[model samples]
Target: MPIASEPGPGAAPAGADPVPQFSEWRKGVAGVLAKVRRVEIAELPDEPEHLLDETTYDGLTVAPLYTRRDELPEHPLPGAFPFVRGGDATRDVHRGWYVSAHFAGPDAAEVNREILAALGNGVSAVWLGAGERGVPVADLPAALSGLLFDLAPLALDAGAATAEAAERVYAALDGYDTASRKDIQVCLGAAPLTSRFADAANIGLAETVTLAAGAVARAETVCAITVDGTAFHNAGASDAQELGASIAAGLAYLRALTERLDIAAALGQLTFRFAATDDQFATVAKFRAARRLWARVAHVCGAPDFGGAPQHAVTSAAMMTQRDPWVNLLRTTLAAFGAGVGGADAVTVLPFDSALPAGELGVSKSFADRMARNTQLLLLEESHLGFVQDPAAGSWYVEELTDALAAKAWEFMQEIEAEGGYSAALDSGLLAERVAATRAARDTDVAHRKTSVTGVNEFPNLAEPPLSEQARRADRIARYGATFEALRNRSDTYLAEHGARPKALLVPLGSVAEHNVRVTFIANLLASGGIESVNPGPLTVDTIAAAATEAGAPIAVLCGSDKRYGAEAGAAVEQLRAAGVETVLLAGAAKAVAELEDAQRPDGFLAAKIDAVAALSGLLEKVGA
Candidate 1:
C-alpha cells in the first residue's frame, strides 16, 4: 500500500521555459499594480512584492492571478490516468450526480417515512445511519421495508454493527424479484479505523473483508468499506489532512481486502466520503485532488484500469451554526454545487437546521429536510449544473489548486506511512495533535473575525426568534461559531431571568455624520453577543450624563471620529461615570483616549481586528450577564 515518490506527469522537464509568452502581459500588469499602489496605498511604505495579493490555506499558496505560464505543462484528459479532470469521460446531462439523502433512526417507521419521502421527491440514494446512534440493527428490515433496492442505492453507516446491518440488508434484498442484484449499489460502510477513532468502536478488519467476500459471492455491486473523511473533517482537520487520512485508510482496507481478494476485486469493495464546505473553490479542488491521489494509488497497485475512486461528498457539519441557522441554506447550496461540479458520484446536503435539537434520532420530512433535498434537486433541474462533465476542468485557478492540494495530501499520507500507518499515528497521538493544531488556528481566526460566520459572528440578529427545540442526534463537532453562540446562550438565560436583555449605552460625541461609522460598529458588535445598544443620538457633553442615567445602562461606549473623540471623549467619559455607568469604552483606538487624565480616560477601547470573543465575553461579564 506504500506508493513510491515520483514527479507527476505535469512536471516540467529540465531546462524548460517557465514563463513563455507572458513578458508583455507581465509588464502591463506591473504597471497597473504600481498605479494602484501610488493611488490607494500611498500612506503605507512600499515593498518589492507589495502588489501581490496572495493567501494561504492548508499550506498551499493561492496566487492573486494565474496565467498560461502558471498552468501545468500537461493534464490527463477526463477518464484518463490520474483522473484530475474527472473519473467519467461523459455524464448524463440530465442527472450529473446521485441526489443522496441521509437518515438516522432508532425508530423504523419514522426512518421509512423519511426515506420514502426523500426518494419520491428526488433522492437517488439513501445513506442510512444504523447502530447505536442511528437505527437499531434489528430494525433495518422495517426501516427499508418499501424501498426499491434496485432504483435507490443504499449506503449504511452502522459503526460497530456494520456486519449485522449488512446481513440484514442482504436478507431484505433476498426477497427482491429483480433478476440482477448487481444493478443495485450497496456501500456497507465498514471503517474500523475511523469508527474506532470517532466512537471508540472496535470493528475487526478481517471480519469486514469476509463480509465483502460474501457480497462478491452473491454477485452484488457492493462496496464493503467506506473511507469516510467527515469524521476527521468534523474533528477539525484541514482539507488536505482529511484527504490524506482518508487515502491512508483506504490503502489500509485495500491491503486487508487484497489478502483474500485480487487487486481489482479489492478496489471494487472500497468507496470514499469527503466533507464539502462553503469555500467553493477549495471544496472543488479537494474532491478533484482526492480522485487524483487515489488514481495514483491504484496505479501503484497495478490496477490502472480501475474506473475511479467512488466519492460521496457531504456538506460540512462543522460549518453549520446554531445561532444563525437560516444562513446554512446558502452555505449548503454552495457546498453542494462544489461537490457536484467537482464530480462527486453522490452528494448529501445536511438539513439547514441539522445542528439544532430535533427531538428525533433522524431527520424527517420537516421543512429543513425538504429544503435540503430540494436544494440538490434545484441544482440539477433548475440550474442545470449537471449538464457538463468536469465543469471546473479548464480553469487555471482550479487546476493549480487541484495540483497543490493533491501534493499536500500526498505528503500528509507519506507522513502517516512514515509514522507506521494511521493506526500507529493515532496511537502515538500524532494525528490528533495535528488536527488539534489546525482547529486552534481556525478558532483563533473565527474569534478575531478573520473568518466570518454570517448571522453568528458577522451580522447577527439579536431579535430573531429562536427555533422550537426538539431531540437531536448527538454530535461532537467543534463548530466554528460555538464560542460566539455561547455568549448568545448566556444572553438568552439573562433575558429569561431578568425579563429583558442586557443593555449598553452608545454616547455619540458629535453629529450623526461624524459618529455614524463607530456607532454602527459598536451596535453590531453588541448585537453579536446578544446585548442591546441604547443610542441616545448625538448627545451634547452637558446632556450625555442625563441620557446615560435615563437609559440605566451599566456600560456606555463613546463613538465618534478621532478628531471628535480627542475634542470631547474625556469629558463624555467623566459625565458617564458620574451618571453611574459602571464602565466607559471608546469605540475608536486606545490612542485616541490616551491623552486623557487617568480619571477621565475610558476603561477600555473597541476597534477593528480585536479578539471579538474575548471582548464580548468581558462585556457580558461586566454587565453581569
Candidate 2:
C-alpha cells in the first residue's frame, strides 16, 4: 500500500471538516449562486469558464487546472538520444546564448562600423542583412575588415543573392586563421522556400548545395541552409502551421541534398529560425515542441543521433504595433525570456519601432537598437534566465501544451509530406490557403476585441500623432494591427483636411447609475478609431437631441442598461432622428434588450460581439471622415 503523506501547517485536525477538492469546491459554490452568476466568481467580473478553458487554433483544449493525473507522456533526460531537452547535458556551460542583432547599411564600410559598435556593446554575433538594403557584393571585404573571426560568429541573410554573398564572404575571410575557419561559427543562410513568399528570387538551392559540399570537403563548420519560419509566422500562420511548414521545408532540403551528401552531413549544414511571441508560455511550448518534433523527424530519417536542432529565435514582428511603440520593449522582454528559457542557441530582439519604417531594410533608431541589444544583456546578466535548461520541464501546463503542440505539428507535417512536400504545397496553393484561413480567424478576433492589442485596439491614444508613410521592404510580412491603424489614419486625414476631428455623440438614457458603465464603454470604443465621443452625461430625451444637434456629430450611439434602453430608447431615438442625426447605434447588443418598440430599433449596433473594425469604418464614412 502507498503511504499517505502527512499534511503540514494548513492541515485540519484529524477529522474536523474534510477539505474540499476542486470538483467539490466547484459544486458547493454552484449550489449557493444562481445559475447565471454561477459562471462568474462571487466578486470578480470574469467568467470561470473563459478563464479556465482555452482552445488553440489547432483544436487543442487547454484545461484550466492540471495535476499529476494529467501527466501522460514521460520525457527523457537532457542530452539523451531524442534530445528533446536540448543535446547538451550541461545547459549553461557556454555562459548563455549568443546575443545577436541584425545590421543593415548602404555600404559595407558603414555596416562594418555598426558591427564594431554592436560587438563593443553586448552583442556577441552579427546578423548581416545582404541585398539591396544591405551590403553589396563588391563591398564584402571592406564590410568585414575589423571583425575578429573567432570572437564573434556571423550569420548572413543575403536573400536571392545568397550564393554571390557566400563567395564574397569566403574571399573576405581568406587571410584569417585557417584553424579558426574550421571552428568559428557562421551561417550562410540560404533559404529558397522562404524566398518564395518573401518576394525574393530563388538563386540559393544549387549554389547552397555546392557550398555545402565544398564546406564538407574543406572540414569547415558552416551552416549552408536555413529553414526560417518567420515568413510564415508573420504571414499569420498558426503555431502548428509554422512548425509543420518549417519541418516540411527542412525535409525537402534533406531530400534534395541527400542525393549529393550523407544525411548527417546535410543535417549538420542546416539551421532553423522561429518567432517568439509575447505570449510567454505559448512561446516556450512552441520552441520546446519544435525541438521534440524535429528530433522525431530526424529519427525517421535515420539520423537519430545527429544532435539537437539549432534554433535562432527572433521576436515576432506581427505583434509589434505602430502606436505606442514603447510598449514593444516589454513585449520583447517577455519574448526574450521565453526564448532564453526555451533554450534557443541564439536570440535576436527586433527594435521596438520595427513597424515604423526608418529607411531601407528597416533601419532602427540608434537608441532603439541599443534598447533591443541591452534587453538580452539584462536577461542574461541580471535576470539569469539562461542558468537553467528546460526550466518548464516539470510544470504541468507547459508539459501538456508541449506534448499537444508536438502531436498536432507532427500530424500537420505528415499531411504536408503527403501533399508532395513543402515546395509542392506552396505551388499548389495549399500552404497559402491554410495560412489565409487562420489569418481570417485571427483578424476576426482582433476586430471583435476578442484579442486585445494594447495601445492599438484596446487602450488607444486618440491624440497620438500618426506615423509617416513607410516604404516596406518585403511583401510577405503581415501586421495584425494594421487594419485598426487604417481606421485611425482615416480620422487623421479627416482632421487635417477639414481642421476638425470626427466626433460621436453618446446619447445616454436613464439615470447615472444605469448609463455610466456603457457611457464609459462607448467613449473608449470611439477613441480606438481616433473619434472623440461627446458625452453630456445622463440627459432627458429632449436635451439629448439638443446636445446631439449642437455637437454637429453625424453618429449617435445610445448608452445605458438594457432595462433603461427597453423603456426609453424609442423616445430618445425619435427625438435624435428628428434632430437630424443621420445614423443611430446602440452600445449594447439588440438581443440584450428584453423589449423594444419599432422606433426603439437602431440603424445598427456597436457592441463587443460585432465586427468592430468594419463598424468603425462605416461610422467614419457616415461622419464624412
TM-score of each model, paired residue for residue: 0.91, 0.91
Q: Native-vs-model 1 lDDT?
A: 0.85
Tens digit per residue, CA lDDT, model 2, 1-625 = 0123555576557755534365565554444453556544455423343344788778888876676545444467767656666666765544688899999877778889888999999899889988764888678778888888777778988777777888887776776765656767778888888778556665657776887776666544778888899988999998999999999998888888888999898888888899999989888988888888778777888888774768899999999888767888999999998887877889999998887777423445788899999999998988777777777876879888888888888888888888888888888888889888988888988999898888888888887765554522233467777788788888888888888779889988888888898888788788888788888777887698779879888889999888777777888888889888888888888785536666667888877777889888888888787
What stretches of model 2 exceed 4 Å from their correct place? 1-20, 28-51, 72-74, 90-94, 178-181, 359-364, 471-475, 592-594
Return the top candidate by lDDT.
1
| lDDT per residue as tens, model 1, 155-239 | 9988788899988998988887788778788999888878766765746888998988887777668888888899899999999
- Our tally of clashes for model 1 stands at 6
Distance from true position, residue 460, model 1, in Å? 0.4
